[model samples]
Target: MLVAAKGERFCDQKRPGCSQCARKRALCPGYRDMSSQIFRDLTQVTVRKYHAKRSQSAIASSSQNKSPKLVKAKPSLSLENVALNFFIRVYAPSSPSAWLTYLESVLSCTDANSQLSLSAVLAPAIAIFSHEQKRPSLMYIARRYYLTAIADTGLRLTSIQHAVRDSTLMSINLLTLFEARAFQGRSPPTDWTTHIEGAVELIRLRGNDQFKSVLGQALFLDTVNNIRTSCAQRRIALPAPIQDLLQTLLQKDSPPLSYGILEIGVGNVVDNIIGLVAGMQTGAVYCNDYKAVILEGLRLDSQVSELSRQLWSIQSYRVLPTDASGAWRWSGLAHDYDNPQSARLWNLLRMLRLYLNKWICRAYKKAVFEQQQQQKEEKLLEMGQEFQHIPETAASNTVLMAEYILSSVPYFCSLILSLEASSSSALSSTVRWLIWPLSVVAVSPLSPVSMQIHARDCLRKLGEEMGSAQAVEIANMLDNSETLEDWYASHPRMIVDQKAWF
Candidate 1:
């Protein structure tokens, strides 16, 4: 039989393999036997394997159910914790004020009142954070904290020992800041003034002992600095107690010399000028004393000039080169310093000069007006020869001081612009420091129109980006009036009254 006919092709039944082989001239392979062709089914084996795997899984799952598993719970953070961390990590570091830097140490104190004072910090911290985060509901919580702090501070004030503690003084300062932040431009003057006065009285009570510790000294300096600024803004003299306390602080050997201390010295001279101007305005000093006032102003002016020279010598700043395009709103060359703090010191010195020279110019103008009136009445040129050029000189100096102030703007703006998105907290302090000087420049009669416009824009930037209400208010004041006198006429509740000065 042929091999190709096996299994697939069948041979004829008669002689099957023999006939096919004989016809094809080849042998055909025979079919296999029945016993060699047997087979077994795999369905039963597959079903058994599937059942075994399912049983194994069920057994593993039952064992797993009998065992216990552990899960870690997330730690919960309270709002107080969140606020404090924000203040310490964000708000405190960016602050230029040394007093706020001491707050971290105060927060770590174990005293009962110190803990209460920590609550005081929450108010301002929450107020600022909520404002930044745009969470209006958090403001209610901030206000509650403010009231709690006030009550806690009130209770502490009842005790003589507690009242003089660093915690108590710090609480008062924090409350003052809260008022400034929470109420902002709309806050009543007395709201913060009362706290400042309270802190001053507490410093008086603490006496020389307050200077022994670093915290005490920082608080004292901070309080004095604040009151000095307030008095200048209100056009009043420093309180008698504060004057005595300042003298005591100066006399101390423990506290190191610092820019703040130097600024205080300048501030004292400023307070004197304010008092002199008030006297002249109220007729407490007669026209005959106008020359005396001018003489006094000149002496004070020299003293401040000397202080400025000393300040620069000790902690010098730089005048960086600028492009000729004058694109940054700077008047001339840009002013820079070793750091933001140094720049602030220089700006403050300039501010003091501006104030002093402004008063001096006012005095000169009054003297000249009186002289003209006298000439009109007596028909004589009896005006002193020495006074002829003084008015013009004073006016020029005032304009120059205003220019210097405007020049410092580039330094601050550079710092602010260079800051990273993560460092926005520092913007507040930097903007706050810039606002007062810029406002002064904007409202000055001697400032050029371009300088005034640039100042108003900078203030507007501060208000929009840094959320400073005072800056916004000042910018609006500038927008509504062509002159400072017009602004005062339109807004009677402004810090400096037009009637008092004009």
Candidate 2:
């Protein structure tokens, strides 16, 4: 053993002991041999230590048993599960077509192709979630998934069996929605229209077979609705194939008196109006024909109005009593419905009516201008007297339709904000549908200043709260464009030419 003085560094263990002491010329103690002392007897001390340890272990075991057993930790949910759940809970319910509900079964399937369906649904879910949460990084992830879905969809389209599959069409439709919401103001306007065109072509390929299943029928109706909106926005006539497909669907299905049925009727009138607008823009329909066009619009308007009346008569709504505190007031009154679906149908009807009256007003102006150029002063005066009430009535009706749309806003907003989770799906559908009506009313020249302001505010709120990028874009458009003409001028894609009517 080597011993050192206090404050000296300890000796490093070595083969020989007392090296430092020997180096210092001091006495060195001999090292002990561990082998010689290997078998020391201490049975009494060992027994005491073992007994003490056993007693401590017994105490701990008894205390643990007296207390509650530990709970098993639950596994955390995966990102895919979270995103999928969000889609089903938030997005699917709000969708008017309910075609998305089919995704549950598609995704539940255990097959290689089901991965594509999962990606397709998740892409939009993540995109919407990113927008709602203001998470830009998540948007890149969303786009990656979107690209994957597009690739998968393209592959599926190569085969007729896969292309017409409900899962495949659902993916395409979901991709279209992603375009509308995720890419709206960012992507070229034609992106959404082109996406919809592709879907329509697929539907044409499927033909009557598309309506065989309930899911397929819902998807077809949804695609038709998208086609009408796209054509209207593009200032083009609805494709003849789409018209033929719709007629075929009606003849074969003969859908019951419902919101979808009423929408088909309104869609026919809308298609005619869209064609009239396109013709007028391309000089196919001359200004001299404005009178006949106005008459046609009125007739279509009457037809749609009758459809609206019949639909509402079957599924009526109530005007919710105005809040005394004015907290729930939107343009002074809020209309409540038996359900959000009915509310959505009603607003769409108002929108079609608004468009009809708007074009009718344009036709009236054009007809009056043509008469002024050709007719003599006396004859022109007489013509003016005869047509005096037409424009005024159209304008007045346009304003009223715009107001009615505004009035419905409060009810939708209330439902979206206060409804329970179970009812959120229907509420969401209503809110999503409300965005278009709100945008239409917000930009209408005939809308009163107060109504326009209210509509714009409602749109802003929806964009902020509901994550509707379209609503935000429309609000921003309203903000930047001081007048309706300015809006049209800035968004040239929405109109065919300067002379075209909105």
What are the Cα lDDT values of the candidates? 0.63, 0.64
Off by over 4 Å in 1: 1-77, 111-116, 185-187, 257-264, 277-289, 376-384, 457-472, 482-502
The TM-score measured for candidate 1 stands at 0.73
| CA displacement after TM-score superposition, residue 100 of candidate 1 (Å) | 3.3
lDDT of 2 by residue, 1-502 (tens): 2344233534445546545655666544555434223222332233233324333333234334543343211112233444555666556665555576666655545444333344577677766666544566776667766766676677678778778777777888788777655643333466666677888889988888877778778888777777776676667888888889878777764672233565556666767877877776756764457776777778878887897788877788787776645543564687777876677667767877887778778878876787778864564324446567877888788887886777777777777777535433344444556666777787776767888788888888887877655468778868988444334323422321111111
Error of 2 at 178 (Å): 2.4
Candidate 2 residue-wise lDDT at 345:
69
Estimated TM-score for each candidate: 0.73, 0.70
Looking at candidate 1, the ten consecutive residues that score lowest on lDDT are 493-502
Off by over 4 Å in 2: 1-77, 109-116, 132-134, 184-187, 256-260, 286-288, 320-325, 328-331, 377-386, 419-435, 453-502
- Report the lDDT tens digits of candidate 1 across residue range 1-502: 2334544444554434546655666666654433212212332232233324333233234333433241111112244545555666667666534567766555555443334354477788777667555666787778876776776677678778778888888888788777655653332466767787787788888887887777777777667766765665555677888788777777665433353556656656766766765566554663456667777777777877887788788788777676557545564567667887666666666766676667666767776688787666542234457666775777677677776777777777777767635444455456666877888888766667777787888899878876776578778867877444333222212322111111
Provide the global lDDT of candidate 1 against the true structure.
0.63
